[model samples]
Target: MSSKSTQTQFDKNMEFGNDTTELIRYITKGDGAGLAYQWLSTLVDGFGHRMVGSDSLEEAIDFLVKSLEEDDFDDVHTEEVPNLPNWVREDDNVEIIEPRHQRLNVLALGGCEPANITGEVVVIRDLDNSKFVNVSGKIVVTAQQFKGYPQTVKYRQSVKLFESLGAIGVLIKSVTSFSINSPHTGSGAEGARIPAASLTVEQADMIDRMFQNGEKIVIRMNMKSHSENHTTTSRNLIFQITGAFRPVNWLSHLSFSGDQQHVNLFKMKRLDEIVHLLNRNGILLGLVNNPSQGDVRFWAKDGIPSVNYIPDKAIDYYFYFHHTGGDYITIFKDGDLEYTASIFAVLGHIIANMDNWGPA
Candidate 1:
């Protein structure tokens, strides 16, 4: 068959005939490809970091709602969710006053109370019970190895434990395995109020070495971090696409009669088909095998099976850029957003047209 005839036959097989062909071609080849990138740019560049309770976050939510409305999506709205305490770091300084006078680069951990202290630095190589003593009224320094974030986060979030022991302040080495003098910052102790900061691995190692050599290591830390306890309203943006077929009460009754395992298997099959369709359309390259957690867990608890897809290359850069000052629009490559948006559009179209998508 001629190329034109082959193309014509392929178009006829599409479920929506010319409409499907036009939509797919427009998404893959037209300006629809850049939609994701454009939206991301507006969110990151225009509104800045969307930290909870921050003005930027509220603005971002508004932007998403408006964007969805402009796209003519049905039922575009925001749902209020619990807010986190607003924490901001104003200024911080760390200096080694003993053994040798030198300054160190640091970033105050989020939600850490502000404090200024000059005390003898004690290095704890591990979180063993034996290391808990003699930490009173002294600066506690702990080394962090490159365990996954979930596994190693306890070291940073232990401010309450350290505070109860009368420790004046806490300094944790960056948890990341790779860094160029970057000090990562994350949530501080949940309930305890104490000053906490992260130091570059090199700085932490030097301090540890000095302490191990029996050198009198005194350090002065000045941090101006602050947190507001008041709760603020936040929102989750949701956009829905109405399916073509109407739901029937009998279908839900029949669905519950099947073996539970079979129901799960069918859901997995549908998910696999969706993934395959995106892959065949050249939207997805490969799967990311890393175990990372995100908002998908919340959706799962609500009985919704959601997939979190990050670009293949994004998995490598996630630690370095995510939740850091390095998270900016510049990190995204050209066509990255466009491709992602196209994939989502195609998936939404397929699901919306399904003959039987059980239960509301």
Candidate 2:
């Protein structure tokens, strides 16, 4: 609205005021309801766990580029980000050799060194104190402990603690309390020389019980991982609707910009995880445990008001699908995708029309 352009040119494509309301209403009704959901579903189903440096992820990015271009955005492109940690999971096997022959469900943590070791597991139920038992030449096992992700993740990040004690490997209990034999994968073991992986909560609990009963819990872990620490290249997709011309105040969100000032919260996919992790350790960096862990902390650090754009409607208790094998499109309810799309589209429209956001 600020720019004076010829009416016949008619190419600004900016809308404001009641036009925003009408556009939002348009996405909710009839065919528009399912647009976002459809695109998301197609991506997930076609790509199937698109990890960095993988061919599937690259192909998926290409797919997104085409989709956004078809939608006629002002500009749609991917900025190549080099030197991303690309630790490929070659093959892993965790079997209880001493007690029985049960292969536990496991996922290798990113940046874990390639290793194949069969050692007794030293179960540490409470990681707060562990001076009693000698973990030298053994594997360390920790649990989620119902303390939410903030507290639970410390066990995963404590690879050096166990390694200093001569522990050869580490196995952390997944972030979710509820488990149906799903191993959650994450990246906290970067630059670690020893191997690390996540085991299901059920199996971790069983290990705890055995340790309590004075049983020699011996497990063999054979994991193979290839690290491409600074060699691999991936992309950050950038697309936006052109806003009305009133100085264009933009809302903040953490990105893969690698700006040390801002934490990266871009990889997190669940609103449930974000909500549950908030307000745990009092009031530090939005109160979500550590600044290195949560992505939303940097915005808070800069005094820029920000919100997690993810939805909170009918959130799952376990977030079982997130970063797990069950993350495919089969779990979504009828019109779930469409409804979420509508909400996002509406929000985008509002932002495009806004004069400015945050501080003056």
Candidate 3:
């Protein structure tokens, strides 16, 4: 991979030293559990729907700026930019104009031209150039079919294509489960977007059946879906953290074999020694995995393999802790019951008996 990408990737994975963890833990404990829960709850709840250019987006920005500032973040800011048009469903309705008249469900397509008059519907097998003679000045109804989004949406824009041939409106087979005469609407774009709507599958089937039976099926559609030019804007917020005695230390050489069960023994032993050592010297040894291993290279094989401890996100920290539960061996080390390695076997063998067991 390129050095820039590698560096960009590395910057995200790195975290602080033991002092950082101690500091975080101390801060959390000092604030009490209730306050912590309240902070998180407010952060998620106050944001609401953050869709660009919407009221929710503005509210979320103000909430973040205030919360981060209160949380002691030195600088918090937002970058503004124009947002895309957000179409919404306004109103819709559909009805069979002939052949056992009935109301069918329908919806308006976004960004479509308004209908001057509720037009009559005409059932057609297809809308190729050849069908223009019979479809002019009437709503064309047909079974909608497509393979994907952009492709499927062609039916929604069928009205505009038909309009070029002097057609009025387009009625599509509702692309939904169970026909309730209900129409579903969606956004569409064109030179001069035309009004479009959908009918339930059942209603579509009835219309097609009439055509197959040599009977003309007609329907009336009244849909209200329009778009207006509006200034849309959105915001992007950013924050950063700071520390004084920042240090980067590389830990290596310590190695072991066996499943996590065995690893826990080593972990307990190290934790006990480190904590006692720290307490005695008025210094702290933070037990943390090397954060640099988060690079994509760690997962990519074949190259010179990096053995730095994988970042916490790569491994299930909670699972490891739970799996090691009750397996830890504690010892009276320097007047404190610290975690130790009394339960683990050396090279998978039980050697030293009870009394012979002493600090190695």
Candidate 4:
């Protein structure tokens, strides 16, 4: 063996000089496997669906921050989080008063203004192409289905659709297949608007029959709706790590740091969604779609709630590192459409050397 090889072996055997060993020791010991599992399982599965502003979400954030501090990370803190306003359903009722009076199924639209007075209901084909010019100050009924329910509902959205036409309120046929004489209430647009409600298919059909018979259909609507706005708390989480060093090539690497870069291939939880959406729109973002041709890497387990750090040195620094202009990355859950149908996100942390950077 050469003199350098023999000397390196002797140093390792005697534990004389090994800076790399110390760096690995710090990370592996600091974030042991068993401890990692415990921390993640307790947060994700145990807490289950921690919605923003909920007490459960706040508790989870507290747990995360405390755990980090326990691991000896310093200067850990949070940034302010913003969220949309909440709208809730209130009491609502609808009924046919003529051509055999009967109780009708009904639901109030979200954000509908409270009604201090009950009003007569008038059914019509369209609010814009209305045959009734002075139909204002009455509950207008229309037959149209609003798209994107639950996420972007429009069950009670007519308050704004016909308010300027002198409409005081609105009643729409429920946007569903089977009518159990049940009305479905959902979110409505903001501001001073008229109250809106829904009616069952049976009741709507009955109205259509009345219109066919040339009999004026009379109905009534009563609603009590309002809202309250207040400040609430939220959370933003982060996972961090240290970088590796090459003592032998330190001078050369530093001199080329600005131009040379690294290419990182991240496996997202929802990669399929990303691929499908991007392909559907005929858009490309420098990503390889096929798994066989893609970079092979290890991903953290579902039970492991924390982020994994994979060291990648294959990328040429001049062309790859920080090429996207942003530091965030995303992981898409392939089949899970219920929670984040399109993507899940992550951020990167690269350090010059472990000893140089620390908690701040």
Candidate 5:
């Protein structure tokens, strides 16, 4: 992948005229690198975890709207959206009490019901019904290796399967491929809400080993997590850079900064063009065939062609810090943010300036 070769290919296949070229050049050379980092710093520093329905989320939305307005962006506004059930974990503790007392690291899953239980730990190696020994009145510990998030997360996210078998509580191994003694938190599916939490891969493995060694493991769990039934309003901040030309309403390209998985190649030709453009500018980016399941899914469902781009090397950043107490501005490097901002700005400017930039 020589830069000269990429540039030659990009020039030969160019469809948009001089305006698009000029816009892309200006964006790539300009000092818009600070924009993304500034926004990220403000969000993480000013408002701590912006969970849905939390005051932090509202404050973050207000901050975004104000920042966009200050930058003189066109159509900067907020739209009210129905909020999901807000779950708050005030206090939670899980400890091994019987087989040599040791406190374990745990994070209560969102939407999990609160409970206090003391029971022998039962390890479920597989989901096979035939191998099921009666796990009645026990704390079930299960670990599933990461195949993919959607495929493997079901064992942990759905509590009904464990509850129906008379499990008092549940402890699932974190979904991440690696862990630094950190537990990840995510929402559970709509089902029998049970006292459920996530344990680091190491911790879960240790528990499983103890169960296998004919050691009786007695664990005590105290979870104060709860949720409000009443719905509240949340805001989605929108900032539009109105195009100079008449915008095409039929197609759209979306780049999400939320999740690490890339998805949905609605317009493959346009994607190829963008990839070439980025590569020509010496910005190495790749597209993967994975379901993003990010916010872009909603746009795609509404009959618009959309695509999502997650930054390279974002997987470690997301798993280690995102949605956890460690998600602070300090976790990000200045150079990385600058590169991300420049690439996004270039892509956005080119798309905004292209004539008849819509679905064929």
Candidate 6:
């Protein structure tokens, strides 16, 4: 971290003490809380799921630009992100056909090329590419448990190897430790295009048990999802709070879709300063020097010191509702969203006010 003042970092708190204190108050306990959640409620409820190529995403972006501009944020705008991959879920049907009958919940993953196929079941509770067989003309059913999303999603999404082995389709157990028969959807890996859908954890486990008990299992996956048109249409919504000092030194509002989001601090001494500020103000969150995902990679690749704030209440239930029908505005606790906003508000204020970029 770089600083102009000779004072030690903690004493530097004296610099932002009064300003940050009031900013925290205004955001957490003042009208800002109501206004922030109001905007969030409108976006999540009014627009619904904002997947690429869907009208909901465009509407959500439009709403953000409009709301931010109306609030008089400086240089509020939407920038076009072109040539991105686009996938949309239209309809799906997953069912056990050979022995009795059951319909399973499903969400066709992003980047899954459309197909309709029926294959014999090969339930693999643990999947490893190097050690596998009997999946050539089968629906590979997986109930790989949740270790962590970054680790577990690989089993769910990485299907190129399975594709190469002549697997027709895949049904991944929702990548979460606990579930009430809720399915979770996410982006498939880059190369695998076989039709795939996420199955509820309960469904995957049941299928695995049936296979273990010597039952001849076969399933039919009839999907009508598409990404046929080559052109991908999406927007990166942005609003800039111009720096009063050092205009070239600016931070951005990080926007991401799907699971890839991370932040790396690059050993900036000023990072410590903001951590102290959050501690003083009583905001609890998980922090890491190098996290694995998109927001961090995008900024860090361009030599920018950006912070990706993921609000964790420590119970780790985020995956339970993500990308499913259960993903709703009601998931957030009272003042939860506002507190997150306050963390960014404080960091943005400090970063915008700094005279130099840190740890460059």
Q: What TM-score, computed on C-alpha atoms, does each candidate reach?
A: 0.79, 0.77, 0.44, 0.43, 0.83, 0.87
Best by lDDT: 6
Model 3: lDDT equals: 0.47
Candidate 1's C-alpha runs over 4 A off are 1-28, 82-84, 128-133, 244-262, 285-293, 355-360
Error of 2 at 227 (Å): 0.8
With a 3 Å backbone cut-off (N, CA, C), the pairs that clash in candidate 6 are 1-269, 260-294, 261-294
**Per-residue accuracy of model 4 over 1-360 as CA lDDT, tens digit each:** 245543332134432223323323333343332343445557766665454456677888888888887886545567667664444445666666765577667666655656643455566654445545466776666654333232223434556766767877777665554334555444453564676766555676667567656876666666765554653557666544433342211110101111111212222312222333333322222233322221121211111112221222222221121212111122112222211111111111112222221122
Question: Which scores greater on lDDT, model 5 or model 6?
Answer: 6
Best by TM-score: 6
Off by over 4 Å in 2: 1-21, 244-293, 296-305, 309-318, 358-360
- Best-to-worst TM-score order: 6, 5, 1, 2, 3, 4
Report the Cα lDDT for residue 120, model 4: 51
Considering only N, C-alpha and C atoms within 3 Å, which residue pairs clash in candidate 1? 33-338
Per-residue error for 138 in candidate 1, Å, reads 2.1
Pairs with backbone N, CA or C atoms under 3 Å apart (clashes), candidate 2: 265-295
User: Candidate 5: TM-score?
Assistant: 0.83
Superposition-based RMSD of candidate 3 using all C-alpha atoms, in angstroms: 18.5
By summed lDDT, the worst window of 10 consecutive residues in model 5 runs over 256-265
Candidate 1 has its poorest 10 consecutive residues by lDDT at: 248-257
lDDT of 6 by residue, 233-350 (tens): 6888777787655554336633222333322232345666666667667776445555444437776565545466666644257777777788888888888888888788877887
Q: 244-268 in candidate 3: lDDT tens per residue? A: 2332121112322223434545444
Task: State the TM-score for model 6.
Answer: 0.87
Question: Residue by residue across 1-360, what tens digits does model 2's lDDT show?
Answer: 123422211123342323434544556565566676777778887888788889999999999899888988656889999887777877788888877778988988877878888898888877777657688899898854767666567787888778877889899888776678898877767878788898898989988888888888888888887686457899988876776554343333423323432333422222222222221211112212233424566665664443443334322443566567666777777755554454444445544454333221
lDDT of 2: 0.66
Worst 10 residues of 2 by lDDT: 276-285
Runs of candidate 5 with Cα error greater than 4 angstroms are 1-30, 128-131, 247-252, 255-266, 288-295, 314-317, 357-360
